[model samples]
Target: MRTQLSIPVTALAVIALAACGAESGPGSGSGGGTVQPDVPVAGVHWTVDSLTVDGTRTEAPDGAHVEITDKGRARGNYGCNHFGADVSVEGDTVTVRPAEMTEMACGEKVQNFEDALRAALTGRLKAELTDGRLILTTEKGDSIALTSQQPAPLVGTKWVVNGLVLGDTAASLPAGAQDKAYLTFGKDGSVRGSLGCNRFTGTAEISEDSIAFGRLASTRKLCDGPEMDVERKLVKVLEGTATYELNHRSLTLTGPDGEGIAAVAAEIPGEK
Candidate 1:
């Protein structure tokens, strides 16, 4: 759910309230009002509960969400599309400015839900943090409700490729390629994966913001058609330095220049 910015009066009011120290509850002294604790929006993955547009209630489509990073980058699944944008938060006011998104087509119901979400998130919205929920309401009465949850870490996790970036577009693997590509990162800085045909292993350099793989060694197995093409591309991506973003059970790995891959967490044999 991403769009361009338009700060509404309600958002302005939130900024003013924060600036004036007009807390939501009573207190005294320099801290004359009881200040509500700031909601930890960054680093936490939020799952969508419901979306209301122009006073009409609508349920969020499956896998809908919005995640904001401390660095102001935002990424989410808007029911029918995957989007990334820049988000700024001042006081209780939050704004999402569009960047890039996948242009995948979907059914009418999903498209409608995505449209509503885009409208609600675009421009400036009044934000409220209560209990464990974060609500964003527009001046026009459109709103989105989300529940926060801890995100899964990338290190020492197994992931299976779901989609790959070709040039500027992202698309799912060709038919018959499902579950054939996967990668497992070890605590010892090693990574091993199946490239849909042969198994490969390599060392990886990981940091807070990026990852680069060292030389990789693989089995000499022959594959034809789509699987072979997938293997070649997957190995190329691994060989390049890629920036990664993780949200809950999903991971997106993009090269410094644009190419990348998207994957979902894979369950270990004994893990719950």
Candidate 2:
């Protein structure tokens, strides 16, 4: 199985914390017959819930998550930058080697949290799974809490464009247009959203792995240079059929020539 762990920190201040061992409370562990000690931990989207170190606990950020695969590979984001590591699972114990992390600069608070998380995840840890939750406890009693999450559906999801894909690389959107471009696909073969500066409505023919866009009508609006640039790129990709790859919460739409946009599922009100 190929596994990955993506960690992320939030705006929450990274205050000093402690090490509290994870106790298998009621309904946890394999003590009860209902608890399966050998549950498969691979290929599950484990959303980080919190981190308890020494004795203090901190809630995880929205995008904090981890996943492991059967291929001995672990990859994930640390709230800001992505990272990967080698891991081994034996019986109920999971051993995580020191991770190779990306050096993207983050805010002081997030950086501090990442440092602390990196330290806690290295070396051998006891793995416990029960009721769709997984806890990995380090030898020093530090533990990370995570819950399983179902993959987001493609339709009816608010996919906000986060980056532009060129060839095999993905680049961030212009600063001014960072969170402006978004799209929502409807069940009625309709698509609508802002192109960073203009609101566009169009017909989308959805196939098993591709989207054939029909005539897209957009409101005529003039915007700043950055916004216009974003709008142009988005329109180009949505002009024709594009292959799409959906990985958990992330989506990549690539046009025929290999240029496209990378989007992520946005949280919707009243939906989990």
Tens digit of per-residue lDDT, candidate 1, span 1-272 = 23433212222223333443454434423545554534454455666778887677888764566665555466667644677765556766666665576676555666677666766767777776666676778777788787765555677667888677745566666767766898988879999989989999998888887889999999999988878888887887889687887768678788766877777766543456
**RMSD per prediction, one decimal?**
7.0, 7.5
Task: List TM-score per model, in order.
Answer: 0.53, 0.69
Candidate 2 lDDT, 1-272, residue by residue in tens: 12333232110001000001123455443563233332344566667778898999987644556666555565665554567666555545556555566554455555677677777876667766567666778899998887777777888889998778888665666667777999999899999999999999999999989999999999999997889998998999999999998878778899999999878778643476
Candidate 2, position 262, lDDT: 78
Give the true-structure RMSD of model 2: 7.5
Task: Give the whole-model CA lDDT for all candidates, comma-separated.
Answer: 0.68, 0.69
Model 2, residue 103: C-alpha shift (Å)? 7.8
Model 1 misplacement above 4 A:
1-44, 48-64, 68-75, 78-80, 83-101, 105-148, 247-249, 255-257, 268-271
